[model samples]
Target: MTRASSQSDPFRLRAWIKVLAVGQLSYASAVAAADLAVPHPIAEGSNYTDWSGGYIGLQGSASGAYGDYAFSRTTVGGRAVPSFMSGDGTGRRDQGTTATTIVGGAFGGYNWQTGPWVYGVEADLSASNLKRPLPSTITGFGYEDADAFNIIRAKTDVFGSLRARLGYSFERYLVYGAFGLSGTNARFIGNYPDIDTGALNVAKHEVSFIGFNIGAGVQYAITESLALGLDYRYLDFGNSRRFSLGSVPGDAGGPVGTQANFNAHQLFLRLMWFPGGLRVPPDPAEIAPHDPDDGNSDRYSLHGQTTLIAQGTPGFRSPYVGDNSLIPHQARQTTTATIFLGLKVTDTTELYYNPEFSQGFGLSGTHGVAGFVNGEAQKAGAPYPRLRSNRYYIKQTINLGGETEDVPDGPNQVATRRDVNRITLLAGKFALGDFFDGNIYAHDPRVDFFNWSLWGSSAWDFPANLPGFTQGVYAEYNQAKFAVRAAATQVPKEQNSDVLDPRVFERAGLNAEFEGRYVLPWLDQSGKLRLGVFSNVGNVANNREIVTLTQLGIFDDINTAAVVTSKPRRKTGGYVNLEQALTPDLGLFARASLNDGRTTSLSFTDIDQSFSGGLSLKGTAWDRPGDTVGLGAAMNGLSPSHRAAFAAGYYGLLVGDGQLRYGTERAVETYYAINLTKFVTLTFDYQFVNNPNYNRDRGPAHFFASRLHADF
Candidate 1:
């Protein structure tokens, strides 16, 4: 669990202002629309509003599903593609599971009313991405004699409904039931890794499914053209058969059939717009206040964020492609779903867990620059779908006595009151970046800057295992004006690996930070400054040592040295981070850091020194308040000793150009996010990278990205 952030007074004031402003706007709209209410000819003198017109709206739904799949596999002949020989050991099987999730989309409809009865037709487009993936073992695509694990994932991307509705009108409300024809576009992906051949295989296919839907709903009119409603819908998409052709040596197909089936039941909230439609007689005493985030007032709540990103770079100059060089003109897409689960164990204690599922690869497999573009994409892109626990922890908060303030509800946070002065203790497995190097304007890639260098002080060399997580215990003391924090974490046994050293006491990393927060006197807005220091003792290989050994013909290369080094190394670094809110709609952030230049990067990427700065602007000026745009730039430099290694044709995981003309790697990134609806956003991003792989001889690269994100 994470402690509630103690925000400055100015920040709290800004939040309340925004909330009140939005409420006022909604109320004003309701009042005006009431005056334009349409009357029902068939229900004259009745209290109910007329329900006869065309309407369009948006909705958010929570759905629970129950389903099953019975798929069969068969091989065509004794010899086809010789890699996988199905039927020899594997055959038909049944797979099933159940879960609940949420979906959001738009709906449009038309209705005709006669007396107290109403008839209509409606259509909607919605999406759901939460489900379990199936796992299998096979041999074929990559090799015949070796068995390997194969993971298969399938999803119903966008499902649409065309329904016929029938309803009976009440004094000021309506009750209706609907049945409809539904269609869905489904996608299937299979990944198999052959241990014998040391390679991975990926297979993909897409198909459309037609189904039926039935549901019931109730609605009440707030004004003539605007109404509030609740709906329940159930959908059944029947089986879709799949067939495959032989691949490699052992992959054969002979009447091999796989069927995909799915069903769902949803309860949704609807906001409808029916211009020149009907309205109910005003009943002030019966009007209920609208609370959008219903469960947010509770001590225990849930939140989630999912994003799908697709990126590509038009061919750039790459005279040669080394192990880590970015491939020109290549494109890739990735999707991630994270569930935030939190529980309040006591008034002063909380527990939280995060589980994530990710699919897709980064551009050129997350290579080319030491300051990689996608912070969410690690080198761990697998041939199959993956599920991992991102975080699990407990937090304790103790009041030291001071002013009391309310903490707003959000992911990993509870709606409660806390003292201005407090001490927080946290222990568990989590990402160091989550607590140490945080920035209001650039920290989370899901909503802010997507580049690693911009989100964190690149040169700090924070100790993190692969997936950017670490195990540790930390303590923080906070006052109205300042905060002090310290943490001790275990380092990974090897570079970028998930395994931590067992003898943690002998190979540990330490971090300490001092934070000073205040409001700019003239601006009357919040701003923060954090200065931090980090030190680590671990058995890691350094660039200088690898280069020296290669020069003496005692080692093959730097990559090889990382696997065998048992010598302990000491590394220390310091960083300065600042964030300032110039206005409610504008903010600025900057970070600069320098490390001891003498040791290996052990965890993150290859920069020993770095500087990054950026400004973020909210879309209030354009009247699209939920949208945002950001502009940022960063510069990364290798230490003298490390530079010597790269200059000698040695390499790190993300960079090594096969030759040398060392220069500082620089990057500039900008993105604009447009909120399509309250729950969905589309972002366009571009980045220009200079001195790819830290080699002056290599290209300046240009990357383009389109991102779609939805949250519940």
Candidate 2:
């Protein structure tokens, strides 16, 4: 192609331009028409929060539940006691009752997304303090108005769930259905004015059971890997199972609790995060299950305690009541060492063994004072060190259900979590005090009050050999606010010896205790009341019979009547102890006990009726937070038969004199303990006695002691 001259090319240019314009116009029209016919896909799909990933989330919910609970006395010998049997819903709360509570927990799950379909599994656990009030007026537990429990309270402690989710995704929103298993823990507590020893009898239980959970949820994506979800769920846990007569939930062959339907409903607002998200999930096998709930750490722990006490009395002597007299100017010392070994065999089983060594002497060999001063001091002893396998036992716990308590590692305790409502079975050797007649403020002499009368009921004479060791079996039914315990122990071969009888059926000790625990928030206080009854079948002399023989000049000593009479008789008694925490730094405790005084003195001191009270105060009030001061008093009285036998110049093992001018033995004791460190304590104690050993002729005297204790 050649161009002509400029003037001549103008005509040719115009012709070329016309052709180019027509071509451009036709192409523009085609592009405009095609744009109308087809448009670009929306960007909503790309912005959706990817569901194909694992996520951990926090969930909060409003929950309500309904159930039935029956409060009846636990059974003994396969039969319910008449006093405790509540056949008429006397202290029961029925179904159709509701309570509202808030719950929060962490949940983790992984989702698999295939096109519009999504599937996932999740697990969660939560805790709550939920309560409801019920109307109930129950009486006759004890023979006092204060013994009645008029108000009933129900509480829920914890819950958990494992769920599988299926959903349909619509771009940025999902609608899902959830199916899973769920469980809850709860209990019922009864209380009123008298509720003495209510700590043992309060209908407190921890019950744990499984149920089916079904729910639906809707979620909205907020980012590529985050979403907000709202869910509604229903749990059908079935009935709250009945506990055994002892309110034991899982005792073999125990009675099932009264049939009671139980269930819950909840609504949750949840925030979720899907890390490592994708639009489409990889192979199912490639998904790793993330579990973080089972890393509680094995609890291997140790504990030990040692106590040394040195006591002295200044020039105090007795003439008449030699058998029960405190000798003149005596100085005594006691040393106790114990090592506790605990093994957690399983989730619900524990084995504990305590090897204890004791070396000590009490004032006048621990005879004069009916209300013994030293709890660790035994009557019969070889001043040389005595080694006793004080506590060797296996405890198996079965949970029924309710709130869970994390049990820290300690002596005779396994480190784990457990339902509050449970049954505990123990067998082997242990102290009767370990299972019965426990007073929170006065129980442990190594730490708290140390007077024997303040430590235990003087008149009950709980069965034991020297050093308070016995072979026996015990069953405990526990709940949130109360507990019931029963035990069968072998009595000593002799009345007050340190040997278990080879024939258990011939000389046995059976005991039952009911306890109640209460927290008074208004007064910032907590209290425990315990009621226990104990019976011992052993060779014993009747004081009345011995006295009759002495009146006829037929008895040289009370022991002669025991040899002439038939085999030993059954001796029974009961005690009630109450301990209250007035404040975080102050406590009050009291105990009253009575026993048939017809029997001669046995394993414990001689007192037919005993009363004791005390107060303990921490030094926080005086800005000395580690110091504690305590003051206590005890009164011991003898039965008419016992007094008469003593009056006739007949001596017994302890507490009998050449001549008897019977008067109640009264003692007042005070102690101040200085805490030098977390594990060490030094205490100074003093006691004043009036009419020691019930003998009016003995001079009132003063006893003093210094105690040093170390524990870990």
Candidate 3:
């Protein structure tokens, strides 16, 4: 019998975002129309506002699931075939396991109220990382019966529910219970690897199920339009019908029937917004008495942004190409949508979580140019949209006695008053660049320049995973005119790998930076300077050693294996960044960086030395102050040993031409941005590169791109 495929398709993240966003806008529009047609006023002497409206919410959940798996004997010609046998031929027919994971999702509902009771109908969808892998129970099986020690792995990637809610209200709080019909998209895999013959076989079953779930929860109204809630749920997916594992074929087990049942317990926190509800104006006493002028006083903040970039190269000079060389003609586009959520836990402490969805790739799969073309593109680009909890962190501020400044709300930053002199501590998963190597005119690819070297110090080799983030702690001491910062973050298990090394103390990255603000004496305009240094310690290869080993025939090809299998080593680097406003509308910026090239490049590019500088001017002179233009140039080089490795045919992470005639890779980029609206902008960019991949044999190359960016 053929196995059943999952019912749900691999829907893109961008599509989901669009659907949710549109739903919200439509509800809000209806609410506006109702308000004009009818007035909703606070009932005289009433203590509580009515809870009757259309609402939407986002939630984070922690859940644990238990499952049991069973298998039946298989028959190809009406003869029973042994299945899931031990190494010694003892039959084992069942397996059991449990898994704990985190989940993120969105929900929507409409509530109806009569007196103190409320009822609602709701629906939700979520992304989950629920998985459990059973250990190999039948190892050491011979080549003849590779399926004997089949290992089972089960996981649920996505789930959703359509539910009804009943609740009772008491002043500002509500208690509720929910019952729902739910569905889960799950996969089960069987791995059969033969130690004797070194052959591997994998069988997979992708299945979806509709089940039942029950839950209870409580919610507190922070305002008439917003609420916070805690929810608990229990879901039961009944035993699945026996299905054949025909994807993996062998005489040991032709096609065994398999079945499983799953149950999960979830506890989640949700933040909800009522589009048809009115917000209660806060009492003046609730504001911080010391700084009433500070922007927003709300304890929580929400912001979002989306960016779409389309880049291409009509055609570039390419006499020959290697494994990692850039294709002469290619065009690609990338889309990213992010939600920034923050909560002020106390006067001096804050928590932040940024859930992001990304899809598409950069030109040439983000390779070819040493100073890559798109800074927004992740190294691990995906053809289909994928969601990641990119940044979740805690921040504590220690304010030293000093004058304070009013802060405006922005992405990941809550609006309030902050002391001019303060010490801040941040711990969690984030990017090192969040606190180091900052330049006013050249930082933030989403806001300014788009080239890798221009937006960042390319030679710093900051520790990060494929998405340019890592788990770490950062500290900053701020003064009126100067600041100092330091951080320690996790490095990847291997270069450009998504998995971080587990040995935190032994394999890590340490970084520090000092920044100063001053007025340019000659120009009478403000300027800033930032100097930073870093050291990364991990198991990595040496370029010189790899070259020598290849010469001695120990390795057939100069490949990534040398770096993948290595002893502990260190890579050190430093960078200097400067930005000065030459005039009211024009600013100049530059960066110089170098890294010790004894060890192979890890986490970043192959360039050991880099110098990048640029100029940015506003459109104020032409009366379109919101529009802007930028120009930048970068020069990248390799150390002597690194040059030799490439010349000897060693492939670097991003660029290698099989053979090398060394020259500095030079790139110049220019862009014009048109402000389409307060929250959206469209930009046209062009770049020229000489000696692509630092190979003199390769002629000059040109690239063109268009980008659409929006934020709120």
Residue range with the least summed lDDT across 10 consecutive positions in model 3: 85-94
Task: Give lDDT per model, in order.
Answer: 0.69, 0.66, 0.72
Best by TM-score: 1
Provide backbone clash counts, one per model: 13, 33, 0
Off by over 4 Å in 2: 1-299
Task: Name the lDDT value of residue 143 in candidate 2.
Answer: 28
Candidate 3: segments with Cα more than 4 A from true spot: 1-297
The numbered model that scores best in lDDT is 3
Off by over 4 Å in 1: 1-297
Across 506-538, the per-residue lDDT of candidate 1 in tens digits comes to 889999999999999999999999999999877
Residues 95-168, model 2: lDDT tens digits: 21224344556789888877677899989886664455543332223323432323345677787899999998
TM-scores, in order shown?
0.65, 0.58, 0.63
What would the per-residue lDDT of candidate 3 be over residues 1-712, giving only the tens digit for each residue? Answer: 0121222222223222322332232223223322221224545544444678888888754221223333344342344544432111001112223233446688999989876788999999988866656443332234344343235677788879899999986555567899989988778787755454556667788878778989876665554566656566778887677665442334443443555566655555566778676323233234334343443455777777766665656454677777667765444556676889988887779899999876555665677788988888788765434689999999999999779987666688776678999999999999888788888788877767888989999998888988889998999999989999999989998777899998988999999999999997888999899999999997678888888888888887767547545777899989999989999899999999999988777887878999999999999999989888999999999999898889888777788888899999999999987775455566777888899889997758887766656665
Arranged by lDDT, best first = 3, 1, 2
- The positional error of residue 135 in candidate 1, measured at the CA in angstroms, is 22
> Worst ten-residue run, lDDT, model 2?
85-94
